[model samples]
Target: MGETSDDGRLGLFGAVSISVGGMIGGGVFAVLGVVATIAGAASWAAFTLASLVSLCVAYSYLKLNAMGDNRGGSVSQLEEYLDDASVAGMVGWTLLVGYVGAMAMYAYAFGSFSVALTPPSLVDAVPLGEGLLRPVFSVLAVVLFVVLNVLGARATGLSEEVLVVAKVAVLLAFGGLGLWYGVQQGSMEYGFEQIRSVTPVVMATAVSFVSFQGWQLLMYDQDSIRDVETTLPRAIYASILITILVDGLIAVVVTSLAAPDVIQQHPERALALAVEPVVGGIGFTVVAVAALFSTGSAINGTLFSAANFAKGMVGDGLLPDETGRASADGAPQRTVLLLGVVAAVFTAYGSLDAITSFGSLAFMSVFGAMCALAVSERDHESVHPLPPAVGAVGCAAFAVLLGVHLWNAERGTFWAVLLLAVAVHAVELLYFERESIVDGVEHAEDLLVPGSG
Candidate 1:
């Protein structure tokens, strides 16, 4: 592990890998199924729009990463941009809602796969329901991921790569199945327009936006990157581009091949329907099992990165010293335990509506804040090609969609959490942090010594 007086900055490639792991999960696999219902034949357009929108925010994050000089995402970055501890703590809460809630939803998703793999009769024998093995699998997945992460960052990265390959394979297979089914039915028209007519496409894009999340993982190890200026941008761009193409391929092919009626009739099983006519049971098993893991990984990765970054923020005097106390092996044991309990509580009460709603809102809010930061910064400060205005547009667009949805949004977790975060920060900033401000100053020197890793 890299080390310094404070912490080790991440390398460019490490940032990129983390971003890929986080972004490529639930947003692509589980989201596409839901989107297929709203978008029909135009699913590709929604995905395409989502991709463009993601880039705008990506620019915002790059700008934020460069300018405000914050390394941890949402929470730390918000403090840098707004210079308000209350807002920063709120950012932290929103982030917790997204990451922790995701873990719960994805855990339930894994249980769904368990039922898929076995017979309904066996599922009926279980406690939750006749067919809800997903919750069980979710807990197992969490335990497994936590263990891998505790082993160290390198272990988590290596294990995640294998999982990622499996995830992409599932997506490709889903597309091929849909394409084959569409061809057999003599109705093969694979294009983005069939589902997106630009206007309604906006809603679809907003939903798909979640699929491209996790780019902020770049900042988890702020001190770890060898060259943040060149490396961070490249990592964010490359990961987004790859994910966009993968999502597009799956969205278009599935919608085109599954047929509008089939998709609407069994939206959740659209991938299965596409494959039923071709590879039979094998294809069905592949998609169901793979999707379960893919989504689960998305949730798992988010929690892992956020917890690690929280430790960093505390180290920077941006948070209380209690947050920085870890075990000898450097595992933030208390933080992880707290995160795990939160995740499990959410998992036990898992609901897709809640997960997507809050995930979308909190995720976009962070991006919007980043855009505000990016735009406010002077150009002499950044090498970004896109202006802060562009980022702002992306940010505003996201906030509007979230506001409209918030009225009936099932994701009230973020708002509730936000209230708590504000209270916590108020207590700290108003009472506890002045003494640490000087400590923070002394620690700033530790950040200057390069190659400490």
Candidate 2:
């Protein structure tokens, strides 16, 4: 339910759940293949490193929240302080781009997962080939998810509960089956240095760290929390801790049972393959179903947050008013649609590689902004486990990684980012700076809406 006041209502458990749902979304599936290709035997270690980095970022957010009343969360708050179209605004756009791409990929993945799990009879009934079905299914998946979102937060929350339960069960079953079968066949061994590789391991760890980025989503829903101070920090830390343990366990089981060759061969089939020997017919089905649910939620969360984020940009004058229009529930229904449409178009064109290249950089840039803003906002620094110094390091690391990502991956996409930044600046200069009386009045009215459950 939406909150009455401008404050949040999400409890500690709710905050943690939101992060968990966000982190496990499609990342768990897509990221697994990438990391396996990179790290091989050291995949688990890479994931662990990634988790630690995510936790570092989380701590930065906690400090930011503690510094002042930041009901606006990361991007919004950054937009407020940093020039909305300044480097700060570009950073927010970067993160939003990542969310947009992630949404598209997840929607596209729905069809691929169906093809892997659906029987031949169902495949034959389809007029299109498997390749064609993927884009069509992707578009359809986006539509269905949007409809569910429009139904309201309560329904989405219920869907999340079911999805989370099914996901956890499948992962656990897959892990158990992998451990048991591999051990029974004398193929299992306990080793100390599971991670020995260099660059590949580092890359895999980084990939896993990004996939677990959803913990920050809770901070956006500041108005939905019952107690911001207690819930926000606790929810973030707890969710990351759980993600670290669960992801490590999954990677370990998969790596031990199925080598880099197997995972890379059918990147989409790694987990299913890992448990097939032990769980046999049923286990494969279970794992596939679970993967579907997890990624689906991830996609949903991305869309959910992206729509509101765009409005945040608009409300702050970074985007157009049409993009910021809200439904009765105060949700940015139009922005959500815009993001979905953009993502669907990208999905339809098989632009995943290009999107991926730009997407990760965009996300990291915003993360750096969050850290940078945290450093700027906080006055009381402490020597606790997570402090401003750590956040400062986190910010620098994120920026450096973003630069490396931009320079190394795809020059075209990096150029595209530069162009995007210029366009953002032009918009800010032409429109955002000269806020109209109508827009400002409307924006103020938005905050005055009484929360009706």
* TM per prediction: 0.77, 0.81
Tell me how far the alpha carbon of residue 437 in candidate 2 is from the true structure, in angstroms, after superposition. 24
**C-alpha-based local distance difference test score of model 2:** 0.65
Q: What TM-score does prediction 1 earn?
A: 0.77
**Model 1 spans with C-alpha error above 4 angstroms:** 1-16, 67-74, 78-82, 127-132, 147-158, 189-199, 222-228, 259-273, 316-329, 378-387, 403-453
lDDT of 2 at 265: 68
Worst 10 residues of 1 by lDDT: 1-10
Of candidate 2, the 10-residue stretch with the lowest lDDT total is 1-10
lDDT of each: 0.63, 0.65
Clashes of each: 18, 14
Error of 1 at 409 (Å): 9.5
> After superposition on all CA atoms, how large is the RMSD of candidate 1?
9.3
User: Residue 41 lDDT in model 1?
Assistant: 65
